[model samples]
Target: MEKSLLKQRLLELKYNNFQDLDVDELLPLMNAMLKYIGDTDPDLRDTLIYSSFSSLILEGRYSNENLRKLLVTSVSNDYLFYGIGRRQDDSVFKRSFSTLIIALILHVNIQKNFLSLVDMEEVADRLINYLEKEVDVRGLVDEKGWAHSIAHVADAMDELVNQKLLLESYRKKVMQTIINKMCYDDDYYLFEENERMVVPVISILRQGTNQFLLIEGIRQIAEDLREKYSSDEKSCLIYRYNFKQFLQSLYFHLEAIDLCEDIRREVKKALKVINQPYYAIT
Candidate 1:
């Protein structure tokens, strides 16, 4: 497939629209198109991604297994993180979101086989780097609608954690990143997305050998919440929900650990205080 021909066919297929088509007719063409896409051009790479997943989304898990296997194998962590397609004016965060979305789809659908094909540490390391670079931490959405980039990273991390694909040493770092993000913003949308990562982050702690990381992170969060509540005018917003969920999850995990009694006492005391009203007339 020449570059010009490949681009033309992609534009043609994409423009022709996603309608009900005979699988026999569409499968071969899509497979061939995916082969030519090989991760060089960002625009075409994104198109290839959309092409790969559109069927599953629109027609219920429709995908060419052999072709998708080839496609997933070709996806590189560098491409996902740094991205080859970002324009001069475009946001890298926004661009990386699409690539990660494609990676998430492949990961969910392919499982360990996909993990076997890629460098799990490299992928996790790059994503953590992106999280650090992220200052705005806004969701892909604007007033127009859903962008889902920031949300996608959280979801991808959740997937990685659930699969036990992230290495143990790096797990604590990932957990810290998420714990920091727990109270990073007040936007309900972003906060809600951040909250989705909490369960997986907690899961890592439960499975990890290090109790200090979990205990310390939870204590800090508890203190953060106590400080937030001290301010009468601080609109804690989604932090209210985040705080409750964090305590519940932390307590659940703390019960399974034998050495964190002091931390537990402090957490339980904070929970009691938070449960009480700001002003009790009784």
Candidate 2:
């Protein structure tokens, strides 16, 4: 529990490049040291925790019951770790650790069908809440010159949908949220953060390659912009948004995903409408 001891253990576990810190060794330490794992205050032991969890999840070390309990309890107790319903920027360690945990859920647990002991529905709900409710506190850029909150949320959602961990209804809801956020161009700071979401949102849509969702998402965005433009007396401000570039990115990514013929045709039609004056809508 002591700061010095926590760091020492972490260094020991991290010794020889995690070669000696296998799952068999990690679960016990995590069980005894979960409270001391992350930074609650001056203790900068989060990196040690992050490194340990990263190894555990990435190395497919979910076979142990204690480890499963550790993950579940950590999420349940510390929403900040995963940014679930969290409005402020988490520590760097927490941000990256949250991402690792989500990746573990998507790849190791869901994909490999491991962790039958873990309540995945609860996990899914937490992830969904993270995407739906959490607020961004890390402004346009941190010292690193990029925001991790949106990117992490976007990446996590993309993985879930790609793995079919989320249902169609939930996927649609997430897509709508992403679209709305991206189209809110007036919030330039948040818009830049939303820009980090575009690729992953497109990646998620590419899973179905249906193009219907893409078309609808675009139409909804256009409608939103039209409403904004009209409300502002048809201001040229809407023209400054550069949604055409976004559509071009969508088109390129969808093509890379090898969209079906019908979907491809729909995409072409949508793009034509998107590029036209008044977006061919007014």
Candidate 3:
């Protein structure tokens, strides 16, 4: 393509509102440009592809399938969206980073009309079902796949509850799922050196109301699951991390707690402990 033409095409992208564009015309143009990015020199390829993906995402022309394809293609092209492994960020940072990103992405997706609460539940179900299918003959665990899918489900549930779709019945169902996973968490150390697998169980514990009764009920479930799942003494960091995660989502449990200012203020304290420096949960 002529340099002048390429420049013009890039300029057009800034103004390319897919809602106004003819999809038939735009998709082909996008495809051609994407192909061109592959031929570009390596140094400049990242800039081009990133620009292109940003444009496509902003264009409102892409759906979940397109985003999935984009992720696969981008990674195949050598994008590392990798994070620290379990041994690395022994702090709660990585888990929160993963779960929090999932939550933000879901928020963005819903705003972009690519997904809904119901759609998210289906995604969660599909992810778990996929992991279940990948298990071995004895129905033993696949730790890696389980962790990945469980994080996905937890984020989806967080979004569902945030959106008010996670009613009492659905909440019960989610708790049961985690409860089932307890046997595995107990059987395997899961992570080396006493790092408890905290996200899923913490998530279940967070489903309670703000009221003392509900909070107590949820705490009991958590204690039971902890006993059922964890063999070692509960890791304090893991406990704090789990506590903070629940605190991060504490608003869901607020209906019951609304009656007490003292309890409500305590939620803020919990958020302080759990929230990232840059952003508080509230």
Top-TM-score candidate index: 2
Expressed as tens digits, the lDDT of each residue in 176-217 for candidate 2 is: 666655443332333444445666666665666455676676
Ranking by lDDT: 2, 1, 3
Candidate 3 overall Cα lDDT vs. reference?
A: 0.40
Local distance difference test scores for all models = 0.54, 0.54, 0.40
Query: How do the predictions measure up, each by TM-score?
Result: 0.55, 0.67, 0.35
Clashing pairs for predicted structure model 3, backbone only: 186-229, 210-253, 210-257, 211-256, 211-257
Model 2: lDDT of residue 14: 72
lDDT of 2: 0.54
lDDT (Cα, 0-100) at 35 in candidate 3: 47
| lDDT per residue (tens digit) for residues 1-282 in model 1 | 566776676676556664534566565555554444334355665554355445443344444454345334333443343443333223443334443544545465444344442456655666676655544444433332333445666766665555554567777777788767655444444345544565566557556547677567666666666667655544474676666666665566666655357657766776765655554512
Writing each residue's lDDT as its tens digit, candidate 3 over 63-134 gives 676554443332221211223222222221222223333444444565554554565565455323322222
